[model samples]
Target chain A: MLTVEKVSKEIDGKKIVNHVSFQIKQGECVGIIGPNGAGKSTIVSLISGLEKPTGGEISLSNRPISSWGVKKLAQQMAVLTQDGLNPYPISVFDAVLMGRYPHLSFFQREGKKDYDKVEEVLETVGLTDLKDQMLDTLSGGERQRVAIAKAMVQEPSLLILDEPTTFLDIGYQLNILSIVKDWQRKDDLTILMVLHDLNLAAQFCDRLILMDEGEIVKIGSSEEILQEDLLSKVYHTKPEIVRHPKWDIPQILLHYE
Target chain B: MSKKLFQRDRMLWLWIPIFLIILLIVMSVSVSLGAASVDWKTVWKIVFSKIPYVGDWVTADWSDSAETIIWDIRFPRVVLGAIVGAALALAGAIYQGVLRNPLADPYILGVSSGASFGAALVIVFGWQLFGVGRFTLPAVAFIFGFTTLMIVYLLARVQNKVRLETIILAGVVVQAFIGACLSLILALSNEQLQTIIFWMMGSLSLTDWSYTAVVFPIVIVGAILSLFFIKDINMLGLGEEVAHHSGVSVQRTRFLLLILASVITGAAVSVSGAIGFVGLVVPHIIRLLFGSNYRMILPLSIIGGAIFLVGADAVARTILAPRELPLGIITAFLGAPFFGYLLRRAKREYF
Candidate 1:
């Protein structure tokens, strides 16, 4: 559904995202895993057209992303960046309604269909009860759910999430990932996410791409890529890779400093 | 639960009447209490005489000095005050939304300084460069103000994206440069020193029908232009990239808003000569009362700002009676304490 061909981004004089190329098939959930400053977020920004790649081409479905007008592109794909916190006292419902902006023409009033979609997304994110509550008054996990509901209301074919669960507790983190996984299965949506937790990526993602120092070092399925030496080499730290006793998924045990 | 719902409904109904009464009382008191101490009865009589068929009952004689004073002098001044105030406040709200910064005001983008420089140049040179006949100084001021913003805008644009931080910095730098040039002109001028000083200090002494005519149309146009962009402005309050992804043409929208706001500020400053604090305080108050929805906030800011400014001007003119105080001084005096209170309150609430 999405393809990146030789994408490179340089800032100031230093290379930030270097010669990265990858593709995700239709209905696939791909997780990009890397340590901090590994161009994971940069890759997402480039694909979303938030920043122009210094050198490369990105295509959605088959058309180059540049050829898609902003509104059309927004209809095709939705993005949720890390800094989604709005300072205003917007309600969860109104915040989610913002996702329908691209679908609206200037001076057009939102109809019942828009409200229905918002309601559906709110229910999906388990935020129906908190719909009227001010976003500033919500807890971190609730706010994140509100953000997710907002992206869901876009109803895009492709969803890009950048470290969405970073601020949530472990339970909420698992809940969010599980929600995304359920959506992937139910809607057959194409999702590309940047995740710091390799184990979660291994368990949930259909494919994983490992990046380090602005370069994609490896890309494969969990069983093929989640080796002990590969994790150690990419992260520059020793880690023990063990198999899940029941599910047989690869899990990592990191060595402390 | 039923009782609670009833109470909530009652409160909602109660709010409209209470606010309306406050607005009415403020407007009436502001009109009647300026400079010359006219009795409430006399003020009412003058007001009634202006009405179509009721003039016979209110006017005992054809030549009523009180009617003329109320209608001619104080009334127009009050109206002008309202329009200028509302224009400044609405511009402020729009600027804050476009920049996505709560602290931004209408004058923060160097528009006001640009206006001052324009007015000062016309005053110091005593030349009508635009050849606009009698409407020379103000026309020149508007031209310079609009041109300066265009230049600042062009300077800040990078690859078609205007950075908010860069624009702000550019505003500050240009403001300082223009201020220096203004000061140099003032230092060199030997004859019109006091006139220049008075103009810079800001006064509504030029409250005439012609001045009103020039200012009102521009202000109304600016306000209308701003109203159309209310949704785009709301999206902009989120951030530029998000707004762009949401189908807003961020750069083009921002440029239009800035130009409109600058024109509003220039027209207002040309007439009133830099009345400080109304733009900054009025919009903040409106935002606090209503939510951050620009659709409601922009209109409210215009009305609320006008009321606030008219009320301030009334106080300025009446307090000293025969001797008029500058509008800027009164605004600064009133606005500083209110601003302090707001800051303290915001800190307590947010922190």
Candidate 2:
């Protein structure tokens, strides 16, 4: 449902996203993995229409992303960044209810249906007990969960997660991704997430797009993309790859030389 | 779960009536406790007697001087104070919300400085706006204030996005430049120096019925327009990106809000001069007492601001009795230390 055709974003004189092209069908979760400065976030920004590409076009369901109204596009997609939300001292429920902005007209306060959506999403994110809790007082994990709950309430068919697990602990990381997993399954959601952890990327994503130096290195299933040779070439670090004991997906292991 | 939600909504409902009562009481007290010391019963009787049909019923047992003091003088001054207070507070809330900075205010945005500069020009040159007479000063002030906001907003925009830090910096620099020009005007002046100085210090004492008539509709209309965007302002507290992700047109919303806030502030400053802290401090107090929700903060700030300024004006005129202090001085004395305390205790985010 999403396509990027030779999209290139130039900042100053340097190319942040250099002629990158990829597509994700409906109901698929694709992971983009790379080292720092690989322009994964820029690609997400372009697709989300937060920033325009200088060179090429990005389209959602065959319509140019720029052609869609911001609110119209928002009703179809939601983007979450690594830093999550600012610590505004808003109640968790109110923060989540903000997701209904696109659905309601101007001067229309959130009615019963919108409130119900927020309540349901808060329950799903296990934050029902903390509905009255202020966002700034929450832990990093909890705040990200609030962000996720907010995104869920947006009810977007396409979800963009831009390195969402960067500051999270391993446990919270798994919890967040699992929540997204369940959400995708239930809603038939399509996800484009940038992941720093290659092992988690292989485990959660059906397809991986490995990138290097603002260019797409390869795109394939986890088995094909997570090969040690390809990863070492892109990341400039030698690592061992082993299959998971249960799921049999390729997992990366690193050791001090 | 639904019951809890219902309870929260109901709780919010109770505050409106509560604040309205407080506002009414405070206004009444402010109107009564001026230099002449009118009694509460006399105050109400005089106030009620001014109402159209009610005036027919209320016996005019009170002296004409007392009626003049209540109706012609204190009543309009107090009402003007409420209008200016509400405008400043509403503008402050919008600035803080849109800029995503707690320190943001109309003063921070150069709106007040620009208005003051325009007023100073009128005072120095004695411009009557080509026979427009009494309103010429405020009209020129409004034009300058609105223009200054546009300039500051444009200066801060980079790559189609307005960074909070950049906008604050832009406003401060613009304010400094305007302040310098105003100082130059002050230095070159002869007879109008005291008028300019006292006007800069801000006072509600000079206000009459005409001033209220000029400012009332502008603030009321700006406030009504602001209601449409309070939710958008709330979304902005999550930052522009998240607000955009949730479908708020951040740039357009920011522009409209800035214009609306500046227009309201321009009107208030035109009539009241640069009353500091009413805008900056009132919204913070509301957020501290209530919550960071703009839906509540915007409306509550209106009442809270009116009460704060009216009360401050009362204290200004009556604190030294015969020798009245400037309203701005009163506000700073009360608002600065309280704001400092808020800052010191602000370990929890109030934004």
Residue range with the least summed lDDT across 10 consecutive positions in model 2 chain B: B1-10
Model 1, C-alpha of B135: deviation from truth (Å) = 1.7
DockQ for all models: 0.35, 0.69
TM-score of the second chain for every model: 0.87, 0.94
lDDT for model 1, please. Answer: 0.79
Off by over 4 Å in 2: B1-9, B341-347
Evaluating just chain A, the predictions reach TM-scores of: 0.97, 0.99
TM match of model 2 to true structure: 0.96
Q: Of the true contacts between chains A and B, what fraction does model 2 have? A: 0.85
Report RMSD for candidate 1.
Answer: 3.9
Candidate 1 - chain A - TM: 0.97
TM-score of 1: 0.90
Local accuracy of candidate 2 as per-residue lDDT tens digits, B237-272: 888889888898888888888888888999999888
Q: What's the distance in Å from true for residue A220, model 1?
A: 1.6
